[model samples]
Target: MTAPITQLKTIEQQLLWLSHWMIHHANHVRPKVDDIKVGGHQASSASMVSIMTALYFSALRPEDRVAVKPHASPVFHAIQYLMGNQTRDRLEKFRGLGGAQSYPSRTKDTNDVDFSTGSVGLGVAITSFASLVQDYIAAKPWGETLPKGRMVALVGDAELDEGNVYETLQEGWKNDLRNCWWIIDYNRQSLDGVVREGLFERIEKIFDAFGWDVVRVKHGVLQRAAFAKPGGDKLRNWIDTCPNQQYSALTFMGGAVWRKRLMDDLGDQGDVTALLERHSDSELAALMENLGGNCVETMAEAFASIDHDRPTCFLAYTIKGVVTLTCRQSAKASR
Candidate 1:
């Protein structure tokens, strides 16, 4: 049996490399007539990679259906390519003639996409309605053969800004939504700026009110393990209390900056100083970056936690544009 974590890492690297390479090929390798940004949303794709990897490769069965986030088109296509459903030629010509579309489209692309998604919030809203439709169908005599599939949505945190999502939530509650999941890529950073503080707290309350089970995928296995360590509690507290913008800025600054920030903030409080002293900068960066939503293992575990198929939402924290050089540079340069 293949180790899930190892497999997750392999899928993560493959998706990251393939997606970014395709974007790079289009922008650089292909001749440009008008100097347009042959854009693939690198940062968005980066944030969703692990979650999708865990969902598609591990959690999902053939019957399960998912609506990919609008900006995470590259990762979805790359996953299809890896699964042998997509061709190399089309991947090379991405966002071009007969190539993979900017967003996964059932009619435009040859890949077996469950739903065609483009605009934000629409895909998410459709999932809840889809669940309603599924339930509707199953109640019929002709729908006996149709198996119940989990209707899932991979959504960006910013997409929650759309009014359609809330409308769907209220509708879901009214219809008794079940066998559906909305996994949010809570990267904190949006196109405009960092997300507001305690946004997820508000979301959690809203979901609870609407009768949806809210699972917060905050700290990954590493951080959770560390919480048991001597000074791990302090580090966890620091992470919890840190503002979204500050956390994102520190991450973009990289490992050395993370170390300095930790030292400055905690200042030898408990085992934090000893912990900082023990690991190298790179190690520290990784430890800090191992957010529960970013970790495929954690995502897989979260996905598994839902056994009864009640309507569920996973608030997954992710890093925006971690591996993509262009996206990282753009985001950093903006600041």
Candidate 2:
């Protein structure tokens, strides 16, 4: 069997190339009268790439279903294109007449979409209903052959603000929901600015109250390993405590700023200091930004390790724009 790391890297590379090509084809290569920037969520896609990879390639069976986040439509299309579920012609005509729809369409798009998405929290909530449907079918005498696949939702953290999501939660709990996974891309930064602090805490508690398994995927394997070293606890604590805006600003500023900030915050601290000293600016930035949703290997491992049918929530942390340049530029320009 191929190593999970190698598979993850392959998934990452494929997603990176396909998503960028789709955007480039639409904006730069294709003819356009309106210079309004066909606006794809490159940053959002980047945040969910690894998570999707793990979910599709490793964690999910043929029966499992996913609802791609709205901004991640490009990445979803790109994945389908690679899997021969989409066409080059359609990709070339993205956001155009008869091209790929802005989001997955169970009825409209030609590709295979388990669920239609675009209305934000609606997509996230639908998975719970799907799970309920699965259970309802299983209870039927004719549904014995129905595959026992989990219904999954890839949610943007910003989507939590939508009241429909909370409504879905209540309904799900009332219905004794099971086997639904809501994997949230908690990048902290949103379309406007950083998300409100402590928002996720409230979310976690709510999920817990509803009997959902809340797996907080705050750090990747690399970051966890780093945190295990001497003084690493301090570094990890610092990262956990860092403000959302500061984290994003440093990402935009690149590695040098990351190093300077780390030193300033946790300098002269034994093992943490040595650890920072070992990595260059770029390396440090990569280390600091090693979020669980961006680590396909970690995500796959987590998914595969799940043995229960309980409603689970993977609060996966991520960067708003790790692999896409256009996404960042557009977000900045809008502000």
Candidate 3:
């Protein structure tokens, strides 16, 4: 990787560690006065780390604004902390009095925040409105010198179920929406269950019909690299066709299971089998887990590829939770 991409990747992991540690501390290490769970969404933040890194560190300018997903507040704060815009003190006191807010709170958080997000669907809807408002402002002579910006929202895939999302799409189409991006973290796993198969295809069509360009980011640099190898095509195909739930299960289960599952599915076909045999279990797992949104470089390249002023939607594949199941439990218990 080049220096810039390397830097972005480093920040991505840093944000991930700080965010997860913040949650862990609040939930597991902090002294509790009562039985209340000091909740933080560790998985949600994990799924968004690469997406946010590409956006804030690689793609966005001072003028561009983003409405971070509600569940990803730790990442939002951690990024702020890394940027020197936020303090370690607040991060250490996360969810405590005068510390970072559980959600991005404009009134509460000391660092810069364009839009306060919570209650799932509302922040997403607001991004579209913000775009419309941007247009409205730019149309005026007094506002003509204002720097134009993309109103971006980093959203969880499950959050798309909100009725207002479709309403916003329709309204944006009617208003000739431009300069807005809704980057959906399409991890496919929800608290209730896995997302319906082919939902991304449906979402793409829906966004296309509404005059917004949709970009689906499924495979990453690692998978794309593997695709260039002998018989990598079949491996790519299998990954593309895999079910959401199965993929999530395999991911959580780790590399040994992934190798076994891939080997069993693909059989002893020469090139394909050799491809799998070339890597250790850990290496295999790394390749398997490298979905586009989990990779900062992939996401950065994707964001850079867009040269248009049209409203865009990025369907970025991500792992819902990066921590182990036990850590997930700790996160909730803290909450």
Candidate 4:
């Protein structure tokens, strides 16, 4: 059990490293013929590494299917590369003629991708339809041998705004959907700017109304544990109330500022105060930054706990740019 979690962590680290490395290799190492940016969404991938790690290495079985988020293509490729499901040549020539597609393609890419994703909300919405399709097939006689797998979508938080997503909700509700998981990357940051406030609140109610179980993966195991302590409540409250921009800004500024911000908000009280005091600035930042979506163990555990196979929505909190450097730099520079 723990072994898979260890592998999940390793996978997360490798995705982080390789995703960045791939972009670096493309920009710095490879020869440039055109002036066009070899633009890879680094920040996007960074935000998704832990979720992918948990989903691929731990929670997912051979039967389960995933539609990789468009921006996290590097991470997906890295995982497939590590698993020997992809070739070295593909990695070496990413975004090239014969390389992996900018976004995964079920028909185009060589990897065993369940759903090909390019457009934002389309991919997310499709997962629900796919689950309905699976159920339709299972009802028939010939497809009885079809594996009992969940149709999962790794969705960007921004993608939720797309009208197709709501259309998907209505469709799923109508079809009596089951065995589907829409894991939203609630990073709050998007390509243009940070997401609107209370976006997930509306999403939660929508999911519930549509007969989906809404599981908000806001805090990881560590943060949840910390919240149980004395001053932990205040810290948790601060985190809960902190605007997306502030969180992203604090993260970009680094750990020292994170410590000051946490202390300034929560103050030095008792057990929670002691807990905060014990950690260095960097440590405190790391603690503060542990979004549930970025915690592989927590995600894997969450994925494992589901039994009834209701159409589920995991509102997974993440950073905007988790996997790639190019995206991180761009987002920061833009800000």
Write candidate 4's Cα lDDT for 1-335 as tens digits: 43365556656777798888887777677777877778788888888988888788777878788988998899999999998999878877788778877899987899888888888888898888888888889989999888878989998888887998899899889889888998988888876787888867877898899999988888876677677766777888888899988887887777688877776876666765677766665556566677788777678888877878888888888777642221122222112
TM-score of 2: 0.93
Q: Give the clashing pairs for model 2.
A: none
List model 3 lDDT by residue over 1-335, tens digit each: 22287678678878889999999989888888987889898888988888888888889978998899988999999999988999888988899998898999888889998899867888998989998998999999999899999999989899999999999999999999999999999989778888999877888999999998888898877778778889899999999999988888789787799988998999889999878777666667778888888877788989999999999999898878852211111122112
List the candidate 2 regions with Cα displacement exceeding 4 Å: 1-3, 323-335
lDDT of candidate 1 over 14-126, digit per residue (tens): 89899999899988898778998889888899888888888988889777899999899999999999989999999998999989999999899999888888888899999
Backbone N/Cα/C clashes per model: 1, 0, 6, 7
* lDDT of candidates 1 onward, in order: 0.84, 0.81, 0.85, 0.79
RMSD of 3: 6.0
**lDDT score for candidate 1 against the true structure:** 0.84
Q: Where does candidate 3 stray beyond 4 Å?
A: 1-3, 323-335
Q: In model 1, what lDDT does residue 302 have?
A: 85
Error of 3 at 263 (Å): 1.4
Report how far residue 53 has shifted in candidate 4, in Å.
0.6
Which scores greater on TM-score, model 2 or model 3? Answer: 3
Tell me how far the alpha carbon of residue 135 in candidate 1 is from the true structure, in angstroms, after superposition.
0.8
lDDT of 1 at 193: 85
